[model samples]
Target: MPGNETTHPLLQRFHEGDPAALGELSDRFSPALMGFAGRLLHEPFLAGDIVQDVYIKLWQRKGEYDSIEGIRKFLFVATRNACINQNEKYRLRQGQPPSSEDADPDEAMRKLILSEYLGLIYQIVAAMPDKLQQVFYLSFEEGLSPEDIAQQLDIPRQTIKNRKVEVYKALREGLKHYKVAMPILLKMLFPH
Candidate 1:
């Protein structure tokens, strides 16, 4: 759903103007995009509106992307830019100046790129087998150490460590296309 291998066929169908493929893409990505926009704008209704606009734009420009990866990148980048514009408009309407803290263009671009890559990583993790997924979420999302995860999951500590190693291997293989180094992925996932 986040531009992994399974999505390649769907993306190919969409490029051929198949409405069902468009629907599939929308179903896969809309919720994540809504959450991303909501975080940026701090308004659930506005975020929904932005995500709707994104779908509309995607339909209108279906020929633009030959790969699911390209589509995924464009979807997030477009949603982010839309959210920034909407935030500025909302501020103007409330008689408040646009936030100067976020005015730096480079910082904004970095945040957008980070968010996109993180979304891809999340998709890969979600696709993992159940035990491995649980291990990874415990390690990263819950900020638990391998020992803590072993206790929580009623598994041996060594098994937990092994599962973590498997998770790293899976992530590295899945994200090879993005050129993400294992160390950076480890920092993002394990974050000590």
Candidate 2:
């Protein structure tokens, strides 16, 4: 992680819509991401494939990136999730579940779901107006209080609350198609 330079170099390149940045990112972070995947997958070649697959996704989605996005966190989380998914799919295809090799399967699944959920959230937030998106993340993700958010962002507390409300309203309306068993009341709570 390079302070102020942006922790994820690939993300920076991806931000600029540079194909070469994707390659440079692969060269720089592949070693680390591959090593992490190898530990989880316990296969060198498969880990390499996993890293490749992760980069492939970045290449595909790079055009959507903007400067405000958190590239490093996104990469680490997405890679871990993709590796987990790939590993599980491979296991299922082989018609064999792990015997003694099983770690906490529930935890693994939770991680995968959480990672996907976060990625979806990022996509939604990124699609929002820049000020509203930043306010929402800082207030919710960073856990800043309304007063704190006002001070940090140099805005009125009421404005932050209104922005949050507007943001939630849009998400609820936008996600009306999802039948996730989540009650509609929760959407109202967003103040959006």
Candidate 3:
């Protein structure tokens, strides 16, 4: 978990009580944390609140974590716990029996990993040029053929093919370290 210029390079500054570093951390992790909590609680509004609180807690415990890994772990765990607590309260308010089905630690962990990975992929895609982004969305997300995308965008079919290659290369470069999950992610992206 070495810090890169694009990712969590502010851990030391954060530990030293820098507000800008905390803001960067919030910007970096909030999306994945919100997605995890939203999936758990099925309420995006509550998820936002929970993620905000988790960041505040992180700021309070800044000295406790020496690395971004520690902060990442803390954010996920704290968000999950907060979501579970909120669910319990909702169940009680509704006069329903408490159920453990959604509280499975393994399932929650899987969702967290998936959300985080997807967030990274989205960040990579978002940084691409507008034309590349359009091609990527049409080809991968919409499962459009190169011919169809070229016709739709009024670009040459060969250009569509080339752009698709560029998108794949970008994704691979960004996600190269996650070797075990690469196949599954590629399968998802390249449905053809």
Output the number of the lDDT-best candidate.
1
* Arranged by lDDT, best first: 1, 3, 2
Computed on alpha carbons, the lDDT of every model, listed in order, comes to: 0.77, 0.62, 0.77
- How big is the RMSD of model 1? 5.4
Candidate 1: tens digits of C-alpha lDDT, residues 49-120: 898898889989998886776777788888888987888888889999886746798887677666666666
Worst 10 residues of 3 by lDDT: 1-10
lDDT of 2 by residue, 1-192 (tens): 335444356656667678787776666455446545654563446877777777787777765654323444556666777766777777777886853234878876765654444444444555678787777667655667778888998989999888877777666665567544334434422333
lDDT for model 1 = 0.77
Ordered from best to worst TM-score, the candidate numbers read 1, 3, 2
User: Best TM-score goes to which candidate?
Assistant: 1
Task: Name the candidate, 2 or 3, with the larger lDDT value.
Answer: 3
Once model 1 is optimally superposed onto the true structure by TM-score, how far is the C-alpha of residue 102 displaced, in angstroms? Answer: 4.5
Sliding window of 10 residues with minimal summed lDDT for model 1: 1-10
